[model samples]
Target chain A: MSTEPPALSADRRREVRRQALSVGAATGAYGISFGALSVASGLSVWQTQALSLLLFSGGSQFAVVGVLGAGGSGVAAVLTSTLLGVRNGLYALQTSRFLGVTGVRRLAAAQITIDESTAVGVAQPERPAQRIGFWLTGIAVFIGWNVMTLVGALVGNAIGDPRTYGLDAAAAAAFAALLWPRLRSGDAAATAVLAVFVALVTSPLLPPGVPVILAALAAVVVGLRRGGRHEAPPTSRAGELPGADPVP
Target chain B: MTTWTTVLLACAAAYALKLAGYLVPATWVEGERRSRVIALLPVALLAGLVTVQTVVGDGGSLVLDARAAALAVAVGLLLLRANFLVVVAGAALTAGLLRAVGWG
Candidate 1:
């Protein structure tokens, strides 16, 4: 196996940054909705801003606020939100392989392995592109999201009722933006349906974040059933599905 | 619950989970099965989130509120392959209209 880092041109790095910037812009806009809702859900501006800066995961932030709005316990809200954010682990693992990072670089890489970073990294044409894409997207999303959160919080405060202006819809709309392009296959569709079903069934019974965790479990089950014939594969290159490009 | 306390605890828990990814060894995460499962994780998590938000929003009630209409419009736009900004704007517009019509 080739352990050496692939050569990357300056143009490639720039391209990666451009891609990251677009994704970041979209994600950042979405964070505005989260900030608005978080405050509207009874969190102080300081609390909402802190969560945006500290947690930095949009889905988990929504889950936390959803639980809070429902009057659930703090422990329950935290637990649920934490569970939903667990996918970052998978992103970190995939990104670590491409970045070939260690020590401080490795730690930083892991910190930035969010959805946009992982997607951009995985979508790159080469390993070097992957590393650049990951870092660029991660940093971009972090910076853009925080700034947008501040904007949203200020607007939400000014507007009073966020629902009156349909601000809450932005989160779902942003997620839809992220999700639509990825649904390219039947298996993905099935997994999505199963997840939605699981969430729908469990939401009423569970606290805010737990339903997402359960949906993830359902997807895992589906994946295990479908891909059970072989051991899991290493990170596939962008534009290549599993079993599409076999390494010699 | 003390709002600040809730926020603090939630933030701490979230950071802990994010940090946990680095703590777990890579060896445990390797394999085709594991990769497939990981690939599906985001969709599953998001689906659950959407489901929860749509079905049992505030007050534990499942009403055909503005949020639902906005989500439906967003989903339609997504299916139609609209640009991300366009999709968001479409959903927001639908929601605003619904609210303006007193359906929200």
Candidate 2:
């Protein structure tokens, strides 16, 4: 693929930005849930906001709050969250080459190099629109998520005990929902089941983080055992934004 | 680690992860085994998290409480193909109702 960005007509550019803004609005609003849930999990509003501002990865942000909420240590939360965010690293591979950005701009691109941006970027038929879509979506989600996180945290804090709103189970529920998409594959489902068993067996005798760590080791074993098998390396990422191109 | 420490450390590490993506050679992560492990890691980690959060209590013992019911409800929604947010809300409502009925 040529690295040079192709020119786009005005109409297409407008359409792309429009789509970006709309998706950004919707995604930003979803930050309210993370904010509320994080607060419910006992993070202060600012702390919740920090997760949004700094980490900037959606599922990973949820993982951090969820892990900590369930009394898992920081190490566990970080490790789990890191695993969740690794896909962005993969996305970054395509993104860095495509964007051809460098210096401070490259660094900025890295900060906003999330699933939403990458998907938006990759989905565009034309190269110019791809760049625009990437930036617009990233900026939109960034502003939207951070601002709404503060709003949600305040509202959640006002609600007193999160359990009243069933927020106590937010982490598990969210993670379960996240897991659903992976269940489409038999290999993934089996890994999940076995991991659950590992988690359950270890929960009785281990620290909060250790069980999850042990469970992750199951994947390491599976990955190594199946390493030589032909599986497609992912070209896209896990960002499930509306209207983004479906990754093959 | 304290929550503050956790937040700071996590933020730094996360940024590093992203930065590493830019700096690390594609060939390293491009290998079949490494990519496979990367893809599967989240599955195992999240499954464990979901299991622990739903079934394991603070004392680190299995406890089938409101959380368990909530997860079951969420699974039902998932089976029905509900949207992600809807699944979360459904779980919350189910757990809340169960707790209110004093069944949990």
Candidate 3:
């Protein structure tokens, strides 16, 4: 991966900036729902707010809420969420190649090396704009998301008995929305269905949360059986484009 | 509370995972069959989560509750390619409305 792509003309720079801000705004506004939902899931305002600040990965954050909201053990919730965050490791591999970052800067890049930043960075044809896009989107989303998290938390704090308004259904709905796009291939669908079956069968016998962890075994089994189809060629399938993972 | 302790430890663990991805040599993690399994975990986890949230409840058994109906609505909206916000609001509305009618 080359670090010096090419010079960015004035138009290209402006175009990159606009793209960065737009991605930032969209991803940032999403933070509001996460903040609200985390609180709605029974996390304290401070704790919810702290999660946004610390964990910062939207999908993992949502997994945490979804599991705990259902009375899951902390271990199950954390393990499930951590499993989802593994993709970040892949994104990091991609980012480290082209970003050419080193020392503390590289470490910081690792910290914010999420989907949007990696996507924006990789999308750029020019090296400078790539770095710029990555940092711009990353920092912008960070500021916007944290601020909106406060707003959503305050709003969530005002609501009562989330169950009364059917807000308790939120965790389930969010998961369904997230799962919709991932069922692209027969294997993925089968894995998902099998996971569902495993959880359902185990739900009665196992304690809360354990079944969800057990369900993850479905993917491991299927992935092993599926063999070498590592990443579906980006164009060949429509399933795994961004925003499919329900961040909220 | 114990929850906070778990939250804190989880946060640290999550951060450690992120950092380790950077610190570990690429050869060890890249192109391994194990990576494929890790990649698919989110899809599996999310599907399991949907099942739990929709059918399973605090009692740890499957039940056809308002959450299930709302999830059906969400599935419909998502298949229609509705925006994320709309999907979320629609599901919440469906559940809220059903509960208002005493089904929840």
lDDT of 3 by residue, A1-248 (tens): 64456678999899889887877787778777777788888899888877777777877888888778888888888888888778777677766767777788876776677777777777787778888888887777777778888888888789877777676776677677667767666667878988999999999888878888899999888878845554555453442335324342
Q: Evaluate residue A235 in candidate 3 and report its C-alpha lDDT on the 0 to 100 scale.
A: 59
Per-residue lDDT tens digits of candidate 3, residues B1-94? 2668667766676676666767777787656557667667877988888888889865786789888899888888887988776777788888
Candidate 2 docks at the CAPRI level of medium
lDDT of 2 by residue, B1-104 (tens): 89988887877777787777888889978776777678777788879889998989877999999999899998998899776668778888988888888876
In model 1, the runs with Cα more than 4 Å from the true position are: A1-13, A20-23, A70-73, A98-105, A122-131, A169-171, A202-213, A226-248, B1-23, B57-59
Which stretch of 10 consecutive residues in model 1 chain A shows the poorest summed lDDT? Answer: A239-248
Model 3 chain B: weakest 10-residue lDDT segment is B30-39
**What DockQ would you assign to candidate 1?**
0.52
For residues A1-248, could you state the per-residue lDDT of candidate 1 as single tens digits? Answer: 85777578888878888887877776777667777777777788888998888777776777678666655667767766676566777566666667777788775666566777887788887878887777887888888889888887887788877667776665566555545544555666778899888877776676665666678786678788854433333555465333210000
Q: Per-residue lDDT of A147-243 in model 2, one digit per residue for the tens? A: 8889989999998889877888867888887676665445566679889999999999987877987898867776777534334333434645432
Give model 3's TM-score for chain A to 2 decimal places.
Answer: 0.89
Any runs in candidate 3 off by more than 4 Å, and if so which?
A1-6, A226-233, A236-248
Give the candidate order by descending DockQ: 2, 3, 1
Give each prediction's root-mean-square deviation over alpha carbons: 5.5, 3.4, 2.6
What's the CA error at residue A150 for candidate 3, in Å? 1.5
Candidate 1 colliding pairs? A231-B32, A232-B31, A232-B32, A232-B33, A233-B32
Task: Answer with 1 or 2, whichever has the higher lDDT.
Answer: 2
The candidate scoring highest on TM-score is 3
